[model samples]
Target: MVREVITYPNPILRKKSKDVEVFDQKLHTLLDDMNDTMKQHGGVGLAAIQIGIDLNVLIINIPLDKEGSEDDGKQLDENLIEAINPVITHKDGELVFTEGCLSIPGFHAEVTRAENIIVEYFDRQGQKQTMEANDFLAIAWQHEMEHLSGHVFIENLSFLKRKKFEKEWKRYLKENSKK
Candidate 1:
């Protein structure tokens, strides 16, 4: 099921998500629904809070060809990754890139993130795992990690840029409301 993505300014998006304790069928279902929702919105990632679920869960699926491949030169059989209660243990270097969120439709901003990072989290199978990510994958991790902490990419923008975005977002909402 593709759940409705809660947009920006929604209270849920500002609230920190809770950690997933019992990795049961319900968690599986949520992950499945999130995956569907992200794909439906043509997003590279989706967080639980984006769908009004205050859980520390997020899915990231970047096509290897699009992101310039993962850390390894070899292509991954499965690029769709589910991170539950993720923690970034290490970060190195930095790069600025334009990022967009499914929740904040029609908005994109330049955000500086680590060029490489080591993340620890539980996979969909309930197994603890840790891996290093670089390049676009690292940026994706940083983006989703912020969502778990109740922070959005817009927060990284300058005050002027954010104000402009607010104006644009309001206009977009009003225009869409008429339809």
Candidate 2:
């Protein structure tokens, strides 16, 4: 089931998620729903918090093809990653990437994150797993992990950019509400 993604300014997005202690059927169902929700939203990644569930769970699927490339629409279910109680064991270097969120649509900002990372997490079956990710994958991990900690990408923006986003977002919300 594709769940409704809770949007920005919703207090749930600000609440830190709790660690998942049980790897049960319920957890598997949530992961499946998250995958559905992410695909439906055209998002490459999603956190349980994005769906108003305060759990340390997130899923990411790096698009198989680059944007604007000839084979742009290609994707594989095998690429889907489900991380439960993820912890970044190591991080190295820095890279800045424009980040967006399903919970904060119509907005993006360049945020600096580790260019490479080693994450320790549990798979859907509760087995421990380790992943070494770089570039876009690393960025996605950092971004979604922050959501689990009650932080948003915009919070990483500079003061001027954040202020501008606030003003513009208010206007955008007003315009949309009038429609």
Candidate 3:
């Protein structure tokens, strides 16, 4: 079963995720939960902080699993790329695309992101790896990586544009309040 992703304006998103010093069953559990949560929410990626876990762990399986690229270049369990202490080391080109966060729910905003990026982080096994991603994959990386830094997709919007989504956001809040 998948877990519901926490939404924006939740204090968890603002708190920087802590480094995962232990690569054990707990970390594996988080990886599983993150993947389940992301899949359930129809999100390509998910961050630990988004799920209210302050750990430097994130799962991404976007353009990758969608295109069968998960079969190539260093296999990870079921295409779930768990990045601990992830950081964007380099970026190039730019692409603006609609983006939404599980935390924010019900709303997506047009946001500009690097079309290509070089990211550095540790794999779930505690091995350091740097990988390059482009197009949709890069966007997914940026989105999830931002969560590690205590930022949400809403922060990508302009003040006025963000205000425009208030009604829809409010509706989500109202509906969720009963849960």
The top-ranked prediction according to lDDT is: 2
Question: Is candidate 1 or 2 superior in TM-score?
Answer: 2
**lDDT of model 2 at position 153:** 91
On residues 24-49, what C-alpha lDDT tens digit does candidate 3 reach at each position? 88888888887777776767788888
Candidate 2 deviant stretches above 4 angstroms: 65-73
Candidate 2 C-alpha lDDT tens digits along 1-179: 99999988889999999999999999999999999999999999999999999999999988775442324645568778899999999999999998889988899889999999999999999899999999999999999999999998999988999999999889988888899
Q: Please rank every candidate by TM-score, starting with the best.
A: 2, 1, 3
- How many residue pairs clash per model? 0, 0, 2
What is the lDDT of every predicted structure here? 0.89, 0.92, 0.81
Candidate 1: Cα lDDT at 149: 94
lDDT of 2 at 66: 42
Model 3 ranges off by over 4 Å: 63-78, 175-179
Candidate with the greatest TM-score versus the true structure: 2
For candidate 3, give the lDDT of residue 1: 43
TM-score of each: 0.92, 0.95, 0.86
lDDT string, candidate 1, 1-179, tens digits: 99999988887889999999999999999998998898778788899999999999998888665465444333343778899999999999999999999989988899898999999999978899998998888998899889999998999998999999999999999998899
Candidate 1 wrong stretches, greater than 4 Å: 65-77
